[model samples]
Each structure stands twice: as C-alpha cells, then as structure tokens.
Target: MSSKLANPSSDRGRVGMRGLRASGAAAALSVGLLVMTGCGSSDSAASSSSSASSSAGGEHSEDLKLPAGWKHAVGTTDFQGIHAETKLPTTVTDATGASVTVTDDSKIISAGDGISSTLEALGLKDKIYAASKDSTSPAGKDAPEHFEYTKQTGTEGLLALDGTLFIGDNTKRHGSVAQQFRDAGTPAVVVDDQATQSEKLQAVADYVGAHDAGVKLVDSVEKDMAKAKDTVKDHGLQGHSVIQITATGAGGANSVAGTGTPGTEMIESLGMTSVGAESGLRGLSREFSNEGILASDPDVIVMAESDYQKWGGEDGVWEAFPTLKETKAGKAGKIIVMPDAQIRYSSPEIGAGAQALARAISEN
Candidate 1:
C-alpha cells in the first residue's frame, strides 16, 4: 500500500447541488427505486445498474405518482432481518466493486453524509474521528475533525489518517473511489445496498462487524418512524399541502423535492403532500417556474438548513425568487428549513429524520 493516495475528486471539485442533480443523486435515486419497487432479488443491483428508471412506490399505499424512472427513495415501515455476528478481519465488498478487509473499526471517519448518522444509530458514534463540517447530525456534533466534505468526498485526505477502516456513501454520493482507499491499505466500505433497509443495514453491519447492533437498530427505526407519524397526526397535520424547495434552485422555490427522492418521502412522512410528486415529474427533480408554484399553492414550503445558510437565509430565499412573496407560503411566512441529512438520504436514521421533519412543520 502506498503512503500517498490519489484524490478521488474530479476536476469539477466538490460537487454542488446542480452537479449532483446532473449525476450523483440521479444514480442514487435509481438505486432507491430498485428497493422501493420490490426489486429485492439478488440480481436487483444488476437491474438497477442497467438503466435509471423510475418505479411505482410500492411501499406507499397512496396513489402518488413517482417521477418517471424515479421511485420513492426514502421512508419505510418494514424492519425485519436475520441476526448474525462477524469474525474479525472480515472482508466486505462495496457496491462500487472493491472488496476490503477490515482489521479495526476504532478510528472511523465519514464523509459526513447520511451514513454518519447511520453509524451513530449503530452505536458506533465514539468510533467516528471526523466528519463533514456541514453535518447537522448528532454523530458529527463532537467529531474531532470536521473536514470540508461538500457533496462527494475526496479520498486523498483520508490516506493520511492511517485509519483501519473507511466508510462512504456510494449509492448517493462519494462512491467512485473505493479502489483508491483500498490502495492505501484501509478497508473501505461503501453503503451500497440501496434496494431495502434490511439489505442496507446488513451490508454496513458486515463491514463494521456490528450485525447484532444493526438488527436492533432496524426495530428502533420502525418504532421511531411510527412515533413520528403518530405525533404529526395528533397535531392534525395529516393531509396538509406542502412543497420542499432546494436553496440552490432558481426562482426561489423552483427547485423541487420531486417524486422518488428522499425529500418527497420526508414530506409525506410528515403527513403532507409533495407537490413534486403530485405534479408528475419525470426524475428526482426539475426546475419549475414561479407560475408552477403559484398553481400548486402549497400551505408551507421547506428547505435544507445547510443550503439555506449557504444561500443566506431569509434574505437569500427572498432574493432568489422575488415572486415568492406572492405565494401562500411566502405571504404567511410559512417557509421552513430542516437539516440536510433529514431531507437527503434514506438510511437507518430515516426515523430520526422523519421525527425532526415532523417537529419542523408542526412548529411552523
């Protein structure tokens, strides 16, 4: 293994909201569709890899129509799995095709994606050494190192840590460099199981040797999600109309949390309607006009806390879409912001995300 590791970053540099919309998130959404559509067979990955196609959200009983070639990529109630223990120095294979042998799990560093929260849910938070500075999850709150992982992670900095094992998000972001970490002698594991929550948790458990913990975490997730929905329903927020807008989107609220993406699922779990899904979008999201927002006329709108801050908060939203002031959400000051992890990835922490989202909209 070389002491120096090649940077896994591309010339484009830290992928931004727009860049991911063009590539990475699209990759993740299709993988999610595989799971949501019951493509859980051993060969589902092969089917997902063949093309980016949307499937109906089979898990949801609603008549919601997913964006074409996109499927519901978040929010689930199922939580059943076989329990197992792992032997030390186990070799795990990443979806990106790299097989890693993990000898230690003490000094873990995450790209600060949803997997960071998943690690915390797995009771491995103390093992995390560093994470993304932009992370809003509890796992990164006391992290020793807060790196600048904006979208996709860079592999070059990880080599210097001399950590025993590395975990990354391949289905959504930071997936292209599994081999790079392998060359550096650190066992690199990517959360590549995208078809189902059970499969996803087990893959991560196998890599970190925490099978029992992973199984328990699933039941916890189910309970938490159920509780979140019940809480929101108690508030009489069910059937509420809402739309999620990304700060990077133009025309203020034009960037949508469209059908089949985590944002839409989060919205639904909170007992709200996703205008993005109702509009019959073709992919995860697409730019819409202010006129479209006026037509949907949602009761409230939401944005990611990270993106909101990056864009400069209230003033930013107003400036991005001057016409938004005319919309119902804007007029009533019902615009809300939630953490990035809560609205982005579908993982074991989805229940927490749902709970957080429930609070955000309920309070607003």
Candidate 2:
C-alpha cells in the first residue's frame, strides 16, 4: 500500500429523547427560553433554523434548534443531521458495502481515534464497549481502560470485546476482520476513511440513531471553527505559508500534508496558505526530501507532537534537518507540534485543532 493509504489523515470519525406530560410542557417552555437566551441566533439564524427543521423529523425535531448566527465554515449545508424519529432495528449500508442492522441498545466497539472522537462528540461515549487505545476526547480519558484495546491490538483483541456492533474504517488490515465480525453475527459499519468532517459526524449519528444530536454537534463545532478563522483574520495572520510534516527515519522519506489532507485543509481553513498545496503536491500525503523543505522555506512548520518528541523535540527537529535552521520558521523558532490524533482525524475535535493552529499562527 502507498504511504497515503497506510496513513490517510483526512478521515476521522456522533444523542437522546424522552417523554413528557402537560405539566412537563410548561417546564420545557421555561427551559427553552433559557436556552434561547444562552444560545441566541445571529442574522443568519433564520436560514439555519429553516434548514435544520426541514431536515429533521420525529419526537426530537421540535427540540432540535441551532444556535443563532450559525454557519458552516467548510460547506454550505449541514449534512450531519439524521432523522430525529429514526428507530432501532434499522439497517445501514456502510462504505464497505456491508449492510449492518443496529438497535437502540446495541453495544458498540469503536476502532480508530477518528471514529472514537466522533462518538464522544455525539454524547455516545458511554455506548462504546471497547475503543482503540489511542482514543482521546473531551468527554472522558478512561476509554482505553474501560474497553481495553489499542492500535497495536490485532483482530483477536477486537473480537474479544463483548459488543453487538462495530464501527471503523475499511482498510486492508481491518477489512477481513470486519467480515469476520459479520460472520460471527456482529454487525460492523465500515465508514469511509476519506469522509469529510460533516460526513464523519453523520456516519456516527446514523449508527447511533440520533440524527438530531449529530446536527447539534456539527453546528457547535462549525461555530467554533468560524470563530477560530475570524480570530486568524482579525490578527492579520492570513496568507502565512505553512508546511505540516511527519518525521520518518534519518534521511528517510518524510510525509508532508498535501492538498486534500486534513492538515492542509485545517491550515487553509484558518486562512493560511499550505506550502504543500502551493508546491503542486496532491493526494493525502507526499514524500519530500530536505532539499524540498529548503526550497519551500515555509514561514511555519507544523508536525505531530509524537513526531516532535521522537526527533528529540524542538532542538532535535533542527538537528534532523540542519538546512531547516536557515528557514524563516527556524529563525523565528516557530515549529508547532500538535497531537497526532487531533490533526490526523476529522472529528468534532477539528474545531479545537483549528483553534490551536490559529493560536500558533497569531503568536508567531
């Protein structure tokens, strides 16, 4: 497999309702007013509300409301909302062409940090019976100990989990394992690895049968993303050249974020120009040499925190590529190292990622 296939950073990978009586209606009205005050809409609030209402149905439809002044930073329409009334025992065909039946109470095992992050964003972290060891989210930090599986754990470890449903990417390494799960009477939903931020949110919502929650989650993230972008623009940080690199071995081929990669997209979303895109690099990631880095001479260098640590941290990066010491970024001491999971996956944490990048750019 190509390096891009082995490490496609573009894909990352989502709630509840209840009954009420006439007296409950009065209480709900009071609470709704409070929510409106706390999360009022902006000028675009009418359009967002219309779009959200048109896409939702069922008991939670009435409860689904976008915060005022909401707008998507990446796309025009929010594709994350699932049908509010969608019940369990429904069959969904995943990107792998496998039709899996899911129920309201299904115990799910999540693989990949991308998918796990989505589950956490959708307030369904409790539903995960087992999660990859690398899973990290704002909802909790004990997912690894709770389920007991890591990226190094093979198919056997995953199969050992007491789960009724599984959600993950359909990579060569896991395709057969997913099939085995299905054969063993466990339905596995294989999400597309290249899915966009909105698509990732929708996939998780579809599996959990909570479209309304998915919409809300997307809206919340998009709002944060917009704020991050505005912060970059207001700080006069737009158009700064950036390159995101992943360290290999000494003199080995290094992978850099190119066009269509999550890293590039995130940087561009913050109003900065990705040097990889400017250099005509395509695909998810491209192999580059030291000479290429010298030629591009980016103003900023972004990398995964693990890679930064692997190379002995900030000083080590300069040691790995002495030529980098002469670049504008090197002179300014601007090497932004972020968590691999956050930059590599497209999940709700994307907003946080954008904010971090924006902060880095502003400071630099």
Candidate 3:
C-alpha cells in the first residue's frame, strides 16, 4: 500500500501563507534555489582511496581524525560515522542570490537549526558565536556562555559578534541586516531550507570547509534510512495511513504534510502513507480542517510531543477531537508523538525519527 505522491499545488494558498509568515517577504520573494559549488581541490582523492582500502581490508582507519570527546558530544540521537578531511575555501550561492566565501578558520555565526546541526556534526560547534532561539541543534542547545539566542538580533548584535561568516536560512536575516554584514566585510550565506537534505548538508559543509564530514554523514543517514524501511516492512506496517497535526491554540491548527515535505518524506520512507500527500497537498504542510480529518480517517495520528503535552496528552487529544475516537487510529490508540526538532528540520536526525515512528507502529 505505497502512498501516491500528491501534487504540490493542491493546497497552495494555505502553504503559501505559512511559508510567507515563516520566511518573511524577502525570502518569499526569492525564486531560484541556492547552489553550492566548490572552488578548489584538496588531497581528497588520496584520503578517500586510503579510507576505502583500509575499510575494504577490514582494518580500522582513523580517517576522520576526530578530536577527543567530540564523538560523545554528538551523542547517539543521530551519530553518523565520522570522516576526516582537509578544509578548503569555497564560495556558496545562497537562496537570496548572495555569494559568500568561507575558509578553514572563519569565525561563523549559525542562525538556523538546520545549519547549526550540520556544523555540530562536523565537530565545528566551537566555531559558532551566536544562533537564534529557534535553533534546536546540539550546538544551539549547548551554545557557549558567550553565545546569544534571540528571535532577531538586529544589525548591531550581528556586527558585535565580528564573525567572518554567517550561515542561516534567509528568513533569519532581513535584507538590511544582510547588507550591513556585507558592508562590514562579513559575508552571510543564507541556505534554502526547502532544499533536499543532502543539498542542505552539502551547502552547510561547503560553507564550513567540512566536505568529507558532510558526505560521510549523508551516507550514514542513507544507510540508516534503508534499515528503517526494512524495519517497517518486517513489522508489516507498510502503507499505514498517517495524519500529523500540530496543536496550535484551542482549535488545533491542522496542517497536512504533503509530498517533498520533511514529514511526508519521513512517513513515506517508513513505508507509511501520508494522508496529506495522498490528497495532493504539498510544500511543507497545508491547513487542514476538522472536516478534512474526518474525511481522511487516518490509521495513525502523528503529532509533536510538545504539542501532545500542551494538549494535555492523549486524554486531551481525545477530548478535543471526539471524531478521532471514531477513527481506526484513535480506537486502537495509534497516535504517535514525535519530537518537533526531528520532524521539523531537514537533518540527519530524520533517520532517527523514521526509526522511532516504525518502533511506535510496531508496538501498537
């Protein structure tokens, strides 16, 4: 029961409004996607060949050359194996059409959770000087004492950091702040959050001069994804209809995860069917009404754990939507609660999210 991919334009109006509010007018105005291109070549070939040989012969190789205690810092939530490499200076074309160059020793300020996670994976957490309050990445959460976390830090705060490079989604920085950074000689690279996971990882890696680490992380995530799919198949939960809703205020703002969206991708990858995708909704998520939920009648209800807690957990959800009690999911207690960070951000942790979903479905 593989789910059909939904058309992206099914609920354009709803998704558009959400996107505009999340990213801002300037980012919404940007049309083309950002491209990350390498400028110089390092001894990557030699290093890769050596690593391949060592692994092929069943020998352990210290290719990543990770610093002591770095691996533990990354933790087991989404620990992709490390790969060592030399840093190279490169230029990246951001979503806003701004080109920013990065070097090995650049002082960086991460403004988004997605980029912050990538930097942490590359063992470059110490390089970050500041981040936004919305950043839930390991580096962001454990941000140093000197790091600042705010919704919008304004130009003065950014200038005060004196960072050589700024990495974040376009929504984090307004046009004037971006220009101010440029005027001050510190270039800002605003990544497209809607890009594929691999692209986002590569863009962040290229900006931070950690190409090998990025590749390894992507590979590890891909491998874990394969295993997750197998787990879903083994549990006989393929094509299970799932609907994810977020509890916003009293009414509970319903948004359907459509094709290409992180939630849809994660659900589909686990061999489950996203009701939102099946209905031809796409692009992040679209506002869904109570009528829509009743019509879809999903087999499973997925919501953020925080949202669940806010809604007074399972009992609260049932009380709010008695119609859910009539659905197969509610009758069987199939509501799955996932962390907001795992479902919201396009990071390697998505693999973990998929696994968690599969486990929950199996248990149920």
Candidate 4:
C-alpha cells in the first residue's frame, strides 16, 4: 500500500507534548547551522556550488569548487547515473580533514531550501528520499519513500548511511544530523544555509537527514534568493512594520510568527522589521497577544496561502483581528498568500517569501 502524506497536526500521535517539548528542547540546545558565515555572508565557493558540474552525458558539468574545510563525497553514495549539466566541484574537504568526492549521484533528502534547491540546481531528482514525512516540494506532495526517520524509539536505532548532504535537524537548531550521527557513528555531511539557522527549518532538515537521504534532497536557497532579489528590491517595503501571521494549525497558535525564519528574513530583506520578532525568538508560535499586535500595528500582514485558509481564509484573519482591519494594510487588503512553499517550510522558501512580501507591499 502506498503511504499518504501525514498531517502536521496529528503527526505527534501519543508522543504529544512530551515529544514536542523534547523536539523543542532538542532544537534549542544544539548549534552550528553553518561552520562559518551568517546569513548575509558567503562561506566559500564550495558553500555555494559544492556539486561538480559537467557529466558524461552533457549533464551538470560545472567545475566543483568548494572551501578549504569542505571535501566532496563522490562515489560514496549510490549515485550511479544521474548527472547535472552545470559546472560543480567533484570534491570538498570537511573540517576534520576528511576528503569527500562528489559523486555523480548523491542521495539528497531535503527538509529545507539548501538541500532541495541544491539538488534541483544540479538537476538531480532521482536520488531524493524523505527522512521525515514533511513535503519538500511546495505544490507537489511527497511519497513515503521520501521520508526521513527523525523520531526513533531510541537514539541507537537511527538510520545509517555512507554519507549525507544534510540540511536541518528538528532536534538541532542548526538542523544538522550530527547528534544522531554521533549516536550511530554515521559519517554525515552538513550543508547549512540561512534557513537552517531557524529552529523550525533546521528541525525539518534534521528529520530528513536522519532518514539517510540528506545528500539527495539538498536545496539551493541562494539560487532561489537570487531569483527573487529583483522582486524584493523593486517592492520597496522599507520603514514598514511587516508582521507574518498564519492560521492556527493543529497546535492552535494563531496570529503568531517564527523568528530566524524565511518570513523574518523576507521582512529584513525588504528593509522592514518583523513586529514581535524578539518575543518570537524560539519556537514557532501563534499566540499573538492583543497588546503585542496593537503595539506592532504593522503596515502589512503576510501569510502562507493555506495558512490563510485555515482561519476561513484571508477574510477570516481580517474578521477575527478587528484591530488588524483598522490598520492601514488591513484596510487596504494588504494580505497575501505566499507561494505554497514559503508557508510550509522555511528553507528555499525565503526567496518566495521575499517575493510575496514585495508584491503585497508594493500592491498595498
């Protein structure tokens, strides 16, 4: 029987609050999303195009150039045939002096923009798997085979693999599979991006990598950002207080937002500030205090389209948050449904979020 997508709401099952708290705690304690730079800075050439370009059949043939500490893990995984038509580095050196060769085919399991976008950039789709049950593609649904095993009964039973091009960890704020790897003695490669810095996005990546499909599912968030840069710059939302709110999910946190998330990044990119960002520095939440909302008095409100629908759609948030209706943005209908991906995951969706914010701001 083919497995179906699991709803995020009922995903915890009996593990409920304990699991969430564990996940949350685990997410808080761990660190090192990127060995080097912050969101705005570039680590190394390898950090950007770790995949080697130019394949046997005119595939991604771009030269693979990485940083000093990162090595390529080629032929390590079972990437038998898939190749890209771009120039990617064939190898990278890790911090431990381990040399990893870039394989023509690497198993990519993404929970964020870095993993999926990277794989998509190289045009390698067949090697992807799901360590977690979360959907990688925004519009398209994922299958069971794409899942990563983040939630194991004991840390000992964690999935094992030759190498992983990992992104995000639900258990780790960096979203890396390092701890799980430490438990299992599995050697894994981490590709940290801006999204991985966010606890929510990182945890998803951690879930995907633990499933042992880390390399196959990598994303290219930089590329996505590049694509949306023009859109954000043109919109000119500078000096605006933008707040991102979504409908309450199964957890029931409404009018709340996440910190260090793509939404926050989008707001920053547009020269806007996230209203209650400081209070929302940890886990994702929707408990927007009325006073907090009033204090923010944002100029714009943006949300994922589906999330918008949860509260009877865009109309619902407006109706429920009466004060929002009185705001300049609310009155002007300055609401937007971000591209499907941005609302779902914080990974590569930053670009989409920026675009959505830009559009809403410009239009409003």
Q: How accurate is candidate 3 locally (lDDT)?
A: 0.55
Write model 2 residue lDDT over 74-114, tens digit each, in one string. Answer: 11112234224445777887777777787643467777556
lDDT of 1: 0.55
lDDT of each: 0.55, 0.54, 0.55, 0.40
Candidate 4 TM-score, true structure as reference: 0.53
lDDT of 4 at 312: 52
Q: Write the per-residue lDDT of candidate 1 for residues 1-364, one digit (tens) a residue.
A: 1101111246644332333334432210111111222123221211122212111111112222221221222233223243334457777677776667788888877764556656655656677887767556656666777776433456566667666667775545556555667776667777753334445656677678877767676666667767778768989998777677665432223366665456676566567777666665522355444444444567776665555555554556656555455667777766654435546554565665576556545655
Error of 3 at 190 (Å): 2.6
lDDT of 4 by residue, 169-275 (tens): 33343233444543454433443323342323333233332212223223333334444455556665456676666554214355455554556665665566665
Instruction: Name the Cα RMSD for model 2.
Output: 17.4
lDDT of 3 at 316: 61
Cα error, candidate 2, residue 231 (Å): 2.9
Please list the Cα RMSD from the true structure of every candidate, rounded to 1 decimal place: 16.1, 17.4, 14.1, 16.4
Ranking by TM-score: 3, 2, 1, 4
- Model 2 quality (TM-score): 0.64
By TM-score, how accurate is candidate 3? Answer: 0.66
Worst 10 residues of 2 by lDDT: 28-37
